[model samples]
Target: DGGGVRGLSSLLILENLMHRLSPEKDILPCNVFRLIGGTSTGGIIAIMLGRLGMSVKDCITAYHSLSRDIFDGPWRPKAWQTSKKVLGLTGDAELRSRRLEEAICHIIARYLPAEEKSALFGEEEIDPCKTPICRVFVVATQQSNGRRVILRNYPIPYEASRDMTIVEACLATSAAPFVFAPLTAGPEGCRETYIDGGLGNNNPVAIVLQESRLLWPRQSVKSLVSIGTGARVPTEVKQNLMSLAKKVAEMIVDAANEARDFESNIRLTEPSIHSVYFRLDVAESMARIGLAEWRMLGAIAQRTRSWIFENHDLLNRCVVTLGGILLNCLCITLRYLSKC
Candidate 1:
């Protein structure tokens, strides 16, 4: 789901779902889903929708602008940076980290009110349990150690300190190696560097499930929707060390296979949950689009639209099920109001 520019596909799918859910007016995902989590580019999307309370259409537009602003320029790595890339060392990225930070800041400023903007983007720590809106979390990997950190807008069951700001969380999660420089931020003494979480936990469905259990120990999940950018095509590696290393690196960063394997495992272990679990992904056409192909937005949108059309029945079922849940919640709220 962290496929650089291919994030358009994920947004397109979400747009369709949101439109189907409320054909009349705009409905934000923050008001619908109790918990949302994603990695890398998906993490950015999660923040826009779940944390910022952005409508699907507005989020899609912001994503387009962000993609163009970030990827429109040419990237010519320095000689030393090229060598570092080949040797698997951290070096200068293809794009400047400042560009990404600025773009995200622009979006935050555009969407948030004046009174609330500073608090969300400032260095002040945010306790997820104290957030008034829906619970949200984004995954980012520690640069020093390969540990996965769950940057949450809600409480984790454990005793983890809330030391990160929302802006820092976004930048840290979106710092894909070789594409964007790793982000270094925090208080003076405890500053830490972070890169994209896709290298380890790309799909993030497992993380959502795990954290959901910790957040609500006795409750059962009624619906879990996992949307993907698209399926990746497998490539044959040459019989050489360099080619093998490159191939291994690609596999380690890619999440398509991991998503498929997890879905398969869910089907095998908990077939009964199939009725509640929904996975939507573009199966074909996207295999050829590279992750950094920002110019291929039109193509990605077309492919995702076609996939949605072909799977109308599944989408309908998902909409109906979620609508039922929404209606039930509304009824409970209405009953409480009547009692009051």
Candidate 2:
């Protein structure tokens, strides 16, 4: 029903009443008071808002505290059990790795467009160390923990290139000490960035990153205003932007940290501990990278012949004895288990 002259007041009461009646168990009900203040609100409001959002966000923080309470959670359904049934009969390590990658890919697809998959600019997306001289390095972080560890390793020989600048638009998306190859500026020197994806045909998007540079578009202003024609970038607005940037920076660092810890845990739990050295086996990795180079190939061949001469036996094979045993210890016991 419409109120006569007091329509705004009636609407406000109704809205406030509804908010008050929302279930209390939701932990966080919407904070509507923020909208009530006039446009002249101080920078503190924006700062508080940034802090509030950061506090509410799910940062993958690791807590080593122990508790005696029983921990119980949800179980998987029949669909997952069926997938495991098929997975159990497979003995190929490559197949297992592919399957795991595929599952992760499924989730990635829902969020990202097709082009931004793991295969962009080589596998070492964010390697800390510089590459071999004569090529470019790329640091595209897929997912990360708080501050450390670039988790993927592509078998590629990095011949470093010269003249690189570590470019980051906002504090949040900045890389840690430049593991990736330095970003060489475009021929034009500086870029005119558009607000969103829209621009000319070649908009020149930066890489799909773990965190976005959320620099909001500045409001348009015109000199010699006629009542409401223009407004400059106020001091408060700039302060708010700074606050937001800081919060985002914290989130990015936390994401990198989480990814770091997860990779470490995966290495510790690997079926073969030797898999730990799989990335760093320079001889084997070099052979993989330079498979096409005849000179490198010959070098690897000579090395292989030398190794063979040193050891007489073949690289022995282990047959799969546990036939079609679809067992998942996830259903049994594991102290650490939580939904992402």
Candidate 3:
């Protein structure tokens, strides 16, 4: 059923199937990963799954989203052809660029399972021609170490992008590409195929699955997945999302325990579209993670900062906008509280 694209990424359809087709079925045993493709549902489902020791490979990477030719790479076919381009791959621009990105994907691929190549770009049946907003963000992850790693910028091969250093990327980019977890309330069964991709839509189901981390999916598991595909522009709504994301990031600095690494401490994978997209919804995001609510966490000292520096970026460099930060913080606090 999960072919490579948008494979079973729909929570709504899944729930519908569960509710109408066979409400008595339990999917928890399937080891089946579902991407909620949103804020609230996906996020919370991941939270619960984390407690179960299941690892989520999130599709919604922080600041990455590109239609790379992931197949058999000489690499950077276009970036290399351009006058201005990335450096240091030892070949011509195209060869270098292609090799570079391919190398990167390869490097990360090493740590990931063979099945999670497009963790975020999980694939879907959505119509790519949709008139709605099409998103391809740099997928971000909330590792078990309390870090939000930008999947694309991971430094196994080299430590920088064409624009800046890894550190800079982490700081600046962490604020934008938000992570999402999907979930569902009431549901039912579905056809052998469900979660149909809307044609002329940017909301690719693959991206949604990638975002949901339903199959042991992580926070926005692999790449930046699209939320939906529609022509209607609710400008006010878009502005609100930007504002909300920004505010959550600002509050993150003082809200958590010692900063986390790219690998979040509590890793989780949400299942189903309804669950995944629901978590991403701003209201649900806030209500479930409580990242919007600022509390005094007693600023972690500069020594901690220096420790990070001393490690030459080896120790911890992960950061979640505000949502992951607060979630990790509360988890950290609870850990100590229990120990005490």
Report the number of the highest-TM-score candidate.
1
TM-score of each: 0.88, 0.17, 0.20
List the global CA lDDT of all models: 0.77, 0.21, 0.25
Cα lDDT, model 2, residue 152 = 15
Q: RMSD in angstroms, all models? A: 3.5, 30.8, 21.3
Worst 10 residues of 2 by lDDT: 59-68
TM-score of 3: 0.20
Better of 1 and 3 by lDDT: 1
Per-residue lDDT tens digits of candidate 2, residues 118-214?
A: 3212334433232211121122221222222111112223432222221111111111111111112223664222110111100011211111112
lDDT per residue for candidate 1 within 1-340, as digits (tens), equals 6777888888898889888999898777876787889899999999888888898889889888888887776555545444456676643353556777888888888887766743333233444334544678888999999899888765554456456666788888888877788888878998899999998788888888788888778887777888887877677988866556556556755777777777788788877556688888887588767666678999999889999999999999888877876765566546655655
Residue-pair clashes, model 3: 120
Model 1 Cα shift for residue 334 (angstroms): 6.6
Candidate 3 lDDT over residue span 1-340, tens digit each = 1101111122222222223222354333012222222222222122222212122222212101211221223434333322121222323323323432443354345444455323332223333232111222232333223333322211112333223222221222222112111111112452011111111111223434433342233444422212211012112223454444434333332111211110132223333322222211111111122211112111111222233344332211111122343344346445655655
Which candidate number would show the highest lDDT if scored against the true structure? 1
Model 1, clash count? 2
